[model samples]
Structure formats: C-alpha cells, structure tokens
Target chain A: MWKALLYKEWIKTRWYLLLALLVTLGFAGYALLKLHRAVALMGAGHIWEVMVTRQAVFIDQMQYVPLLAGLALAAVQYLPEMHRKCLKLTLHLPVPALATLGVMLAFGVAVLAVLFGLGIALLAAGARPVLAPELVGNILHAALPWYLAGVAGYLLGAWTILEPTWKRRILCLLMSVLLLRLFFLAPVPRAYGGFLAVLALLSLCAASLSWLSVVRFMAGRQD
Target chain B: MTRFAKLFFWFLVLVLLLWQLPWAVNYLLVQSRNTPFTLYSEVLDDFVMIRHTSDKEVEYRDRAGNEYTRRAFDSLLPLFYARQLTADGRFPDSVAGRPVTLREAQIASFIFRSAPKDLNRPAPGLHFLLESMSGRVDLAMPSDAFRLTGRGIEFIDMAANRIDTAKSGRFTRMLLRKGCRFPVRELSGNPSARKEYDEGYLLLDADGGLFHLKMMQGRPYVRAVELPEGLRLRHLFLTEFRSRRTLAFLTDESHRLHVLTMPGYGIRRVEGVTFDPERESMTIVGTLLDWTVCVDGASAERYYAVSADDFSLLDTLSYPLSERRIPGLSFTSSSDRYVKPRFR
Candidate 1:
C-alpha cells in the first residue's frame, strides 16, 4: 500500500521534481564557478580568508536552498493530490491517513535526498581540499549549531503553510527568522553553555511544530 | 495562536539575530564590555565568551567577555605592525644599527623620529619600536653602522653619517617575505623587522644595559649587556631623566649617574656603556627623558644629554615641555627594545 501511494505521489509530481532538481543543480554549478574564483584569490588553502570572503555567498545558498527545495517538493507532491478527486478515492481505500501521510513524507524525503546528493557531489568534486578529514571535522564540529538553525527554519516553514490562522502563521515565520538570526549574529557568552541550551530549545520547538502541522494536515484533510 | 504559527514566530527571531553574525559582534562590543565571542555558520550561529580579570587572566565567559578581548586585539596588531613598518620605512637602515660588512672598527650615525600607527589603549601605551634584519636596505649600509655581538645591534641614529665605509645618503629596497603557510606577496616600500624590539616584556638598559627576563616560552631569565661608552647604568625610573641620558637631576657624591661602557662590573658589549659612580646614601631613581642620551665625567650629577629633538641642549639636559617632570612625558618602545621618545 505504501509503495502504491508513493507511486501515485510520484506520478503526480515527477515533472516538477525533475525541473526543481535541474534548476538547483544548474544554480549549484554557477555558485561553484564563483567559489572557484574565490579559491584562486585565496591561494593554495587559506581557509580563513576564503571563508571570510565567501561568507555572504555561502550564507545565501544555505539560507534558501534546502528549505526551498523541501517546500517545492511538498507543493508538487501534496497540493495537487489534496485538491484532486483521486485523493478522495485514495483515502477511501484501506490505507490509513497515517500511512498515506507516511508515503507522502517518504516521497518528500526522496526529493530532499536527491538535492543533498547533488550538494555532496559538488563538495566532493570541487571542494576537494576543503573536503579533507580535518575540514570535514570542522563541518561536523559546526553541525550542531547549524542543525538547530535549520530545524528552526524547517518547522517554521511547515507550520506557516499548514496552520489555519494568517496572523499567527506570520508571527511564527517571523519568529523562525529571528531565531535563526539571533543564533547566528547575536554575540552569546561562551561559558555556562546558556546560549546553546536556548538554541536547542528553539530548534526543538521548530521541529515539533513542523511535525504537528504535518499530522494535522493528514488527519484533518482528505481533499 | 495556532501551534504552527508560534513555532514559526520563534524561528524568525532566531534567524534574524543569528544571520548577521559580524554585525551582532559589533553590536555587543558597542553595547557593553560584556559580550561573547561567536563564530557563525548556517548550522551554528553563536559561540563562547571571553573576559579579562583583575588578576590579569583572560577568562572565557559564555557569550560576551571573551569576544571583547579578542575583537579588540585582532584589529589592533596589524595597525601597530603597519605603523612600525611605515615609520621604520621612513628611516634608512643605517639609522638603526646596520651590520658591519667590513672587519675593521667603524662608526655610523644618522637621525630617526617616527610616530605610532594605531592604538589599543591610548597615546602612552601604544608606543612600539621595531628592527628588521632580512632587508638589504639595512644590510647595504656601513660595516659599523651598528656594532653587532651576541648582545644585540648598537650605535643607532645621530647627527652625521660617520661610518668609515659605505657612502652616505644611499638608499635601496628589499622584498620582505613573511613566511605564512599560504604565501602572499605584498609591496614593502620601507619595511623593517622590529617585532621583538617593541613588545613590553623586555627592558634593555642600565650602566650595563640589562633586559628583564620576565616573558619566555620555557625558562625565564633576565639578560644583561653592558652598553657603549658615554652612557650610564642607572635604575629604570626614566621619569626624572626624561630625554637626558646621564643623571643630572639628583646630587649624589658616591652614586654619580654618568653611564659609560668599559668592561664594567656588569657590562656586556660589542660596545656597551657602564655607570659605576656612586654618591653617598644614593640608589638611582627615574629614567631620563627617552629622547635624550647622556654621557658623564665623574659625579652622579654630571652628565650630558644626547637629544633626539632639534632643540640645542647637547651640553645640558632640559625638558622644555616637562619642565623637569617625569610622569607626564611618555616614551615609545620597539616591540622588544626601547626606542628614543620625544615630548608629547
């Protein structure tokens, strides 16, 4: 049943997914070209200078790409299905709302995995020097902080779309942006681990909200 | 009040503040002394804190204090290096004691005066002096521009170019290659290497010039060297003898303050100066004005000031601006060695 639902979802959204993937990879190529110029200016491997100089560019990509991909994937898969007459027929079958929601999520995840694969390929091919174990270690070291930021954005995006209220949804979206900015920009004291704790809490809140939005959408809507 | 809405709202606040990490650091420094030092990434936005304590220890506090110390120092060193490089550039290498290309004894003299580039604290503390070895400009000068031994270089700037060998007024340029892991080519018009010369840890002076051995990588010990002739070995209280090399301020029969370099009791030298004359009931006090170097005959009170300033006071020592005050006047130093200071 899950495989059948996934097949149905793919049938609805394959074209959009393909287009999103193509455009995304195309943009990645353009970005890598820019990064190559920056790398040349940075010499053999002046990591710090390269980082500082390309900070703005990396920031733009990180902020928009993943979640925008996720959103696009979601729209392609679910929005059309929910509004179609076939959605009601699919629901009337023995498949539970949970199972149907699961397949939709799995489809969403597949799209995400493809996008992430492209990013990894770019890193492996172009960022060879920076892709070393130590640099990878650095990226891992920063994983927790950026993970929290991403979760917050993800939840906020999911919630704003699924939530019924206009004003409250806007507020949540604004909160997500604010939380992301604060965690990145605001100078927090290093000791006592207070800042990290707060960021963890915000990240959890975003994730929880996203999960709640998805569950509510599945349970409450057939069309 | 939708559940989804609340979540999104908080995320917005977080991202807004976190994204502008550089600006946020600036804001923290401006807002208060307390702010954490943070490095930004999409995954991780904020970081640890740092602070300075009364005990002179740098402590990493969460989010605030650590950053102030780092941010303040990070922007400060380059300005200092640049200023020292630029000012030192203004000087011919011969002004600072250059190496003797010839084996024979020779004398070289020139004049040097420079101001600091940038400051961390204020006018007085920012003074730094520098010396460079790699440059051909300093090397191309006279053989005896400065008498070099294990002690250090000597016979710095003065009136006329008196080094026996090498023509005066000759200038040249050399490339200063700073060996970083990643190489960068920068144009150096007049660059001198003086990092070790300006840092405040070492004090190189006395009848026999002594450098305090407080700062070290492993073991710590004060290094002592005797200075050249026509100099004094006195206490390091430079306030009293601002600009004047020999002590003329106080009257002591046994503790006479004219320092000359002759294989003294504590003199170490390629050419070092010593001051052994003592007046009854006297321990030396106050450094002479930084600009003035003095030579003495016999008495503690009898010394001549070799002034760096243009005002004629070679036969005597006088602080035209200080009017014989010490604390108000400031002295500039190289990263390691003390350079001559002018009145404020």
Candidate 2:
C-alpha cells in the first residue's frame, strides 16, 4: 500500500523533479565554475585568503535556487490533486487519511533531501581540489541553512496549498513566511550552529500542518 | 493526528507572535540614542565631548558644562589634533612640560577598538603566519596557512591543497619544544601587509599557557610567555601598533584588562578597569601621556583615563543610556553572529 502511494506521487512529480534536479545542479555547477574561474585568474592562494579572512563562500548565487525548487515541487505535486479534487478520493482509499497524507509529505521530503544532498556533494567535491578542508567546511556550513530552508519551504508550501479555505491559506502563508525568516536571520557562516538541529526538527514537525489542511478539506471547509 | 496537528500549528503561531509583536512595537516607538563622542583630555583633566546640536552645529564641551570654540578645542586636545595644529602654524613646541614634535606625537598615537560581535563570531580555524624578518621592506603573506589539531599544528599549502609535512613538522617541533600544548584554545593575529610589521600570533594553549609564535626568514620563532600565578586569560588581542611599546591586550576570567608590554613581555594589570570582551565594546586612544579607554556597555558608556606608562587609573566618567526597549524573544543579537532563541 505504501509502495502504491509512493508510485502515485512519483508518477505525479517525476517530470517536475527532473527539471528541479537539472536546475539545482545547474546552479551548483555555475557556482563551482565561478570559483574555479577565480582560482584560474588569481591563484588559489588568493581564493583561500579571501575565504579565510573575508568569509567569502563563493556559492552565494545558489542560495535561493534550492528554495525555489522546493516551493515549485510542492505546487506541482499537490495543486493538481486539489484542482481535480483527487485528494478526496485519495483520502477515501483503504489507508487512513492521516497515513495517506503522511506518505505524500514523506515522499516530498525524501526527494528534496536527495536533490539538496546531491547539490551539496557536488559543491564539496568540486571545491576540494583547490581549497583546504577548513575552507570547504566553511562553504558547507554557510550553505547548510539555505538547504534547510528548502525542506521547510516544501513542507510549508504543501500546508498552504492543501489548505481548504482561501482566507486560511493566506494565514498559513504569513505564518510560514515568519517561520522561514528564522532560518535566514543571521548571515554569518556557521551562525546556526546547534540551533540548526532544532530548526530541522521544527521543519519536520511542520509536516503535521498539512494534515490540518487535509482534515479541514475532509470537513467540507471552503473559501 | 488531527489534534496533534492543531496543537503544533498553534505552537508555531505563538512563536511567531512572540517574535514579531515586540519587534514591531520596538520598531515603531523606539528612537535611536545619539550619544556624544567622549574622550578624556589630559590638558583639561576632564572628559571632553563632541556632539551635534539640534541647530545642526557641532558643539565641543568639557564635562563641567564649559563649551569651547573649535580652535580652542584643537588647542585643548593638542596630541589628538597635532597635524591640524601644525598645519595651522599654532603647534605647541612642548606638551605637558616635555619636548615634543609632530612626528613623535603621530608615531606615539594609536587607536584600538574591539567589539563583542568580533569576539563572539566564528573563527576560521586556519591562520596566516607572515614572515616577520624577511629583510624586505614590505611584508608579504605566506603561501601556506596553518591549523591547530588535536595532535599538533599542521600547515597546508594553499595552492596545492595538501599538507606540507616537512614544513609542518619543523614548526610543530619548535612549538612543542617551547612547551605549547596541543589544540590551542584561543589564538589572535594581525595578518595584513599594510601594517608596519608583523607580530604573528598569540596562542592560549590547552593548559592555560600563553605562547607567541611568529615566522622569521622562513623559520619559527616561538616563545613561551610566562603567566602570573592563577592568571587564567580568557581573551587576547595582538596589537601591532606603530610605537611597538605593547605586544597584546589580554582579559582574564575576572574581566580585568591586562597589557603585555614589549621588550620584556611583562604582564601588567590595568588598574580599576573591568572589560568583558564578550559583552561590551571598547575603544582606546593612546598617546605618550595617557590613554582614554571607553567601554560601551548596554546601559552606560564608561570612560577611564589611565597613565600610558603604568596603566594606572587617573579618572573616570560615565553616561547612562536611557533606552526604551521592549524585548521578548530574539533569534539574532547585535553582540553575536549566531541564530538561537533568546529571551531577555
């Protein structure tokens, strides 16, 4: 039953996921290309010095790419279900309604993890050649918060999209914006530190928010 | 599941309210404080202030409610405004009954500033050790950087992105021979070519020992600085000032400031001054006569006049800040570079 639900989500989001993968990887590659071009122009020593002294990450261009990918993925996966009123039927399946929504949210979260993980790996592998381990660690630490925001963006995007009433959807969006603002409050590298784990947990708890929308949808709430 | 979801949703709503409501109120109602720039004057024996008046004019005054003209102010702080006084042909031949010159005054003067945010931020573990005695007029940055590990120091060539084992071993041996424990707790250095010269780094080791490490002609110059008994230092600032009279400024666990003087590395406690480098911002204007040290705190800004020779407290002044703040929940702070839930 879980496999069937997973297959349904995959079939729905497969094409969009492909595009997201490419766009995210393309942005990551472009950032790496710029880093290497800097190294080629002014020796690797210059890059390392800047990264050390000035807190230059060299991947700031890709900061918002993951966020957009997550938001878009949520829309592609859930908007169609709502437009066609297929969520009603999906909830009426043999599985419990909460379990069904849980599977859907889990699928979105998993795919986002894979996508963001690949982007981070690509950055680290590309940066390892011309940078020391410390510099590479600095770059990764700076990017960690942005990637976490992508996960939160997907979950909150689903919560907003699955909300039954238009007025309530706006409220959910306002809350999400404030909550996401927490992820970007500090610009310094490694500023999140241990707070990142707390943020990740809160982001996962946001998965339950989509269930609230599903319950409202089942109760016949409307705009 | 529905009940849990509803509870979680309300929790998030409460968090946002606590975070945003106070911020919005403070933004709407709070006015920024315009504190005067205060400095202690040896000639006046009082704190002098420079402030902007409501009529869009600059006012210079002493703490005793005495205002002075701009030229009079320049004459009062002759050391601070020496260049201007010299250019105007009104420079004093001697100050404080000692023979002085514009060159001596300029070389003896330096400004040192440290903020809480600078000390509270994350440190990039790698450090550059420039050649201190390369026989060249201008110092150049080294091709490699070093990191302190659990075992010893490791130097990595930046271009090759690999460890230079031979060079690393040589420095590691010297540091070990100098009795520096592994994994430095805190290290400070000024690593720019624009400075007069390099003084390398001041390292606090695991055993609460202080060591001075620098590179001279591609070799290591490590000195184990002896600390006074039970003097556990919490922070260090390596000052490469033009006069070269002092090597670094240190703060101990009791928040008392200490100065490490040059030629002998003698650690002298600056009397009657307490500066917590983690919470307050401090600025010091030094001359051959005295230093005007300003410690800006959350509630008040305190000024101390200390003798440059012995760092003994001469006088003190303070101005209390009347800040109208509505603090509830804050994730970011002006004093730190971290994002964490803090309530004040």
Candidate 3:
C-alpha cells in the first residue's frame, strides 16, 4: 500500500520534478559559467582573492532558483488534486488519511532533497578546482539558507494549496510569506550559520502544517 | 491533531507579531543622533567641536563654551584643517609655543577608526603574504594564499591550484623557530595593495600569544610579540597608516584600547577609557601634540582627549544621545556581521 501510494505521488510529480531539476541546475550552471568567465578574464588567483578578501559568493545568481522550483513542485503536486477533488479519493484509500498525507509529503521532500543535493554537489565540484577548501565551504554555506528556503517554500505551498477554503488559504499565505522572509533576512555570506540548524529543523517541522489543512478539509470546513 | 495544529498556527502568529510590532514602531519613530565633529586643540588645551545649530547653521565652540569663528576654528585645529588654514594664510608659525610646519603636522597626524562589525566577523581562513620588500613604489597582490592548520601554515598557489609545499615549509619553519603555536586563533591584516605600506598580519596563536608574520625578500620574517603583564588581547587592527607611528591598534580583554608602537613593539594603553570592539565604534584623530579619541556607545558619544606622546588622558567630554526607538527582536544588527536572533 505504501509502495503504491509512493508510486502515485511519483506519477503525479515526476514530470514537474524533472522540470524543477533542469531549471535549478540551469541556474546553478549559469552561476558556475559566470565564475568561469571571472577566472578567464582575471586569473583564478584574482577570483580567489576577491572571494577571500571581499566575501564575494559567485553563486548569488542561483539564490532564488531553489525557492521557485520548490513553490512550483508544491503547486504541481497539490493544485491538481484540490482542483479535481481527487484528494478525497486519495484520503479514502485503505491507509489512514494522516499517514497518506505523510507519505505524500515524504515523497515530495525526498525528491527535493535529491534535487537540492545535486545543486550543492555541482557547486562544490565546480568551485573545488580553482579555490581553496575554505572558499568552497564559504560558497556552500552561502547557498545553504537559500536551499532551505526552497524546502520551506515547498512545504508552505503545500500547506496553502491543500487548505479547504479561500479565507484560511489567505491566512496561511500571509504566514508563509513572513516565514519565507526569515530565510533571506541577511545578505552577508554565512551570516545564517548559527541559526541554520534551527531553521532547517523548523522547515522540516513545517511539513506538519499541511496536516492542519488536511484536517480542515476532512472536517469539511469551507468558507 | 487539530488542536495541536491550531496551537501551532497561533504560535507562529504570536512570533510574527512579536518580531514585527516593535520593529515597525521603532522604524517609524527612531530619531537620529546629533553628534558633533570633535577634535582636541593643543593650542587651546581644550576640545573643539563643530556642530550644526537647530537652525542648521554651523557653530564652532570649545569645551569652555567659548564660540569661535570658522577661521578661528580652522586655526585652532590647524593640523586637521591644514589646507583651509594654508589657504587663509592663517597657518601658524607655531602652536603651543612650539614651532611647527604643515609638513611636520601632516607627518605626525593620523586617523584610526575601529568598528564592531569588523571585529565581530568571521575570518576567511586564507591570507595573502605579499612581498614586504617588493622594491616597487606600489604594492602588488600575491598569487598565493596561506591558511594556518594544526601542524603549520600551508600556502596554496592559485595558478597551480595546489599547496606550494616549499614556500609553506619555509614560512612554517620560521614561525616554529619563533615559538609560534599551531593553529592561530585570530589574525588581522589589510591585504589590499592600495595601502601605503604592508605590515603583513598580526596573529593570535592557539595559546593566545601574539605573533607578527611578513614575507620579506622571498623569506619569512616572523616575530613573536611579548604581551604586557595581565593583558589578554581580544582584537587587533593592523594600522599601516602613513604616519607609521604604530604597528596596530589593539583591544585587551578588559576592553581597554592600546597602541602597539613600532620600532620597539611596545604596547601603550590609551588611558581613562574602555572600548569594547565587539559593541562600540571608536575613532582616534591624533596630531603631534594630542589625540582625541571618540567612543560611540549605546547611549552617548564619549570623547577622550589624550596626549599623543604618552596616551595619557588630557581632557574628556561627552554628549548624551537620546534615540527614541522602541527596541524589539532583530536577527540582523549594525554592530555585528552575524545573523542571529537578538532582542533589545
């Protein structure tokens, strides 16, 4: 039953996942290309010096790519279910409704983890050859909050889209925006170091928020 | 489950309100500090201030409340307003009964500023060792960088994108011979080539001992500086100012500002004041006679005028600054480079 449920989620989000991967990876690749251009124009040593002395993170262009991808994934996975009332049938399966929702969220999160992991891996690989390990770590640290924002965006999008009524969805959205704003508060690289672990935990905890929407949907709460 | 979810939602709402309400109030009503531009006048033996009046007119006054004309003010702070004094033909033949020249004033004067954000930031773990005696009029940025590890300093040659073991060994051996502990704690240097001179870096070693490292003529010149008794240095700013009177401006754990003088590497505390580099901003305007040090604090701007030769407090003044702000929760601060939640 779990396998079938996971398969159903895969069937629903597979194309969207591929598109998200391509878009994010394209942005990441573009950032790498810019770094390459920097190295070509003014030697790799110059690039290293700028990064070290000036705190220049070349991957800033990819900051919002993960966020947009996450938002899109949530929309792709949940909007159709809500639009066609297919979520009712999904909940009516043999498995418990909460478990069903959990499995679906788990699937989305799993796929996003892989996608974000790939983005970070590409960044690390591209930066390693020309830069020192400290610089590579700095670049990675700079991108961590943005990647976490992507995950938050997905979870918040799910929470809002799965909500039963218009009025409640608006409330959910205001809260989501405020929460998403937290991830982008500071422009300094690695400024979010001490807070990131708590933030990531909060992002993962946010997955439970969708269950509130699900419970409201189950209770037939409508505007 | 519904109850828990409902509780969580309200909790988030409360958090948002707590964060935003005070910030909004503070943002809308916060008043700017009307701090004056102040400097010590050795001729008057008093602090001079140039400030804007309520009508937005410039007013020059001494600490004794004696008003001065703009020309008088320039003459009083001759070293500071040297060009203006020269243009007005009011450049004095002597100040404080000592014969002085514009060139002498320029060479003896220097301004040093230290901010909290610069001291309370993350280190990049990499440093460039420029050739201290490159024989060029202008300094050049190095092609390699070094990082201190548990064992020794490792230089990474950027062109080859690998560790330059030979150069690394040379530096590491020099530091080791000077009895520098492995894995330095905090290091400070101005690596930019735009500066007048390069003093390399002042590093605090693992055991809290101080050391200076520089590359001179393709060889490592390392020296371990002996700390003054009971002084544990917390922050260091390598000041290679044109005057070159001091090696660095440092703060000890007691929050006292000290000047690391050159030639002998002697440390002299700037008496009668405390400056926490992690919280306050400090500005020092020094001339041949006296130095005026201004410490910007949370509630007031404190001024301490000291003798430049001895760093003894000559005079002191302060302006109580009242900023009408409703303090609240904030994750970002002007006083720091880190992003973490803080409340005030």
Best by DockQ: 2
Interface RMSD of each: 18.3, 1.1, 1.5
Q: CA lDDT of each candidate?
A: 0.35, 0.91, 0.88
Docking class of 1: incorrect
Instruction: Write model 2 residue lDDT over A49-145, tens digit each, in one string.
Output: 8888888999999888888888998999999999999999999999999899999999999999999999999999999999988888888888888
In terms of lDDT, which candidate is stronger, 2 or 3?
Answer: 2
Residue B171 lDDT in candidate 3: 90
TM-score of every prediction relative to native: 0.37, 0.98, 0.97
The residue-by-residue lDDT of candidate 2 on B87-160, one tens digit each, is 99988988878778999899889999999989898878888999999999998888998899987889999888
- After superposition, the stretches of candidate 1 with alpha carbons farther than 4 Å from their true spots are A38-63, A81-93, A129-156, A164-168, A175-211, A214-223, B1-344
What ordering of candidates by lDDT runs from best to worst? 2, 3, 1
Per-residue alpha-carbon lDDT of candidate 1 for residues B140-200, written as tens digits (9 for 90 to 100)? 2111122222322222221121322221112100001111111111101111122122111
What is the Cα-based lDDT of residue B23 in candidate 2?
A: 93
Rank by TM-score, descending?
2, 3, 1
TM-score of 3: 0.97
TM-score of candidate 2's A chain against the true A chain: 0.98
Regions of candidate 2 where Cα sits further than 4 Å from its true position: none
